[model samples]
Target: MQPTMEFLTSEEAIQVDAALLSSKEKFSTRLAIYALRCLKQIAAEKEISVEAVTAQQVSDWIKKDENIQQQLELDSNFELFFTRLVLSSLKPLKQIAQSEQQPIENLTLKQVVSWFEQESKIRQE
Candidate 1:
C-alpha cells in the first residue's frame, strides 16, 4: 500500500526513532534541484550568472506545476519505494553521518542530490 501523509506531521512517529519523513523532504529537494538546473541552463545560455535566480523562480515554477507536485506528493508508489531504499541504506547513511559528526538531516542539498543521482545511475546500469 501507498504511504499516507498523516505520518508527516503525526504525533505518533515522534515517539519512535523513525526517519521516513526524510522521504518527503527529498521530494522538496528534488524540486529545488529541478529549479536550480533550469536556472543554471539559463545562466549558461546568457554566458553569465549575472541574473539573480530567486526563490520566486523556484516557487513560481513549482506553483505552476501542479501535476508534478501532485505526482510527487500524492501519486504513484515512489514514496514507498524511496522509503524502502532509504531503510536499506540506513547503515551507510549513519556511517556517513557519524564520520562527519552530523545528523542525516544536516546533509546538504548537493550531498542528498548526489545520492539520488547515484541511485539513478545504478538503476540505469
Candidate 2:
C-alpha cells in the first residue's frame, strides 16, 4: 500500500515562504511568485500549509545551479508550461499598465512577461 502524505497547516505554509525568501538563489521576482503559486497548489493538493514548502526547498529542488539547457533536456514541456504561467500572470499587470496610461515599453511587468515568453520559445527549440 502507498503511504499517505501528511499536510501542513496555513501557519506552516507561511514558514515555507520565509524559507524560500532566505535562499541564496536569486530568483526573479516573477519566478519567485510563480514558485509560490506552485507551492500553494502543491500544498492544497497535499492538504498542507504552503509554509511546508519553503522557497529554499523549492530553490534547492528546482532552481539551484540548474542550467536552462539542462532543464529543457530534462523536461521539454517545462518551457511551455512556464511560459504559459508567466503570460497568464502578466495579463492583469498589462491591463493595469494600460489603464494607468503607462507606456507598455516602460512597464516592467510587460517587459518581464515578454522576456519569459521569448526565452521559453527559444528554449523549447
What overall lDDT goes with each candidate model?
Answer: 0.43, 0.44
Clashes of each: 0, 8
- Residue-wise lDDT of candidate 2 within 1-125, one digit each (tens)? 53332233344334433442323221343453444355545556666654454444443334332334465566867666554544444444444346556633334433334444444455557
Given candidate 2, what's the lDDT at residue 13? 37
For each candidate, what TM-score against the reference? Answer: 0.29, 0.32
Best by lDDT: 2
Estimate the TM-score for candidate 2: 0.32
Cα TM-score of candidate 1: 0.29
Residue 32 lDDT (model 2): 37
Candidate 2 stretches with Cα past 4 Å from truth are 1-29, 32-67, 108-125
lDDT of 1 at 101: 76
Candidate 2 overall Cα lDDT vs. reference?
0.44
